[model samples]
Target: MSESLLRVVPTVPDWVPAQDAADAAALVVSAMCPGAGELVACRYAEVTFIDQGANFEAVGCPVCTAPLDGDWWQERMDDAYATRFATLDTVTPCCSATVSLNDLEYHWPAAFARFELQVRNPGRGWLSPDEAAQVSTVLGSTVRQVFSHY
Candidate 1:
């Protein structure tokens, strides 16, 4: 894991603007919790934008306990729509699940593209030895990924 460092603030850096970030944050908060009442109920009062380059991970909320992976797909879509980041080179079946209120469905196509996810840990989570192999394999892609962790 990489150690967190304290340093002087940067005058100029590669980043999106503060206003844009607030707008983006608003969009995210709204989507996650729709309706004005919910908006008022939920706390999105302060949105902090810390520059954690390359390695970034989302911590799940306590109530819904939704995994950050839930947002990962939409984030990719946003990248395609907003930033036009490229997709993985290969899409392989990683996991499967069924979602239903009344009827049960089987055999859902829940796959993970083993493309350059960059796999930067950012020192937040520890990477197991086995996980490191998978990360290495991702780094071995022949084609260049649009969003590079480097």
Candidate 2:
């Protein structure tokens, strides 16, 4: 059976205190996915890609909204991974606009982050903007949610 995950990550790929992460996770569970178990907070040594698993559809340039070539995106991802994601800067092939890979328009809202709060089988829809803002307040940073199915 497939399970859904709701991953909350900071808007910027920066670190936050473990307590802050735990508080954010607790907030999401209590206010939204009360039945959700396996809540976890993670902090990576470096920025890492947090994808939406099989939910991913397409990615596009944030500037021109042109559909990005998969091969080109992969190449850029590889280059960034080589540096442990220290940099996500790239030039969009469509408009030659310089932007961060993290800023791309992803269909399922993927992101790069050093910290994440994940709830497995959340049993609820996406968080409301108000709820997300509450989580953001708890974490002291703006947050984005990534829904993943696997």
Best by TM-score: 2
- Could you tell me every candidate's TM-score relative to the true structure? 0.18, 0.93
lDDT of 1 by residue, 20-91 (tens): 433443343334323222221111222212223343343332234344343554453354334322322211
- In order, what lDDT does every prediction score? 0.26, 0.86
lDDT per residue for candidate 2 within 15-126, as digits (tens), equals 5556755675566556677878678887888898999999989999999899999899999999999999998999999999999999999998999998888889987878
Best by lDDT: 2
Worst 10 residues of 1 by lDDT: 100-109
Decoy 2 TM-score against native: 0.93
lDDT, model 1, position 70: 32
Worst lDDT 10-window in candidate 2: 20-29
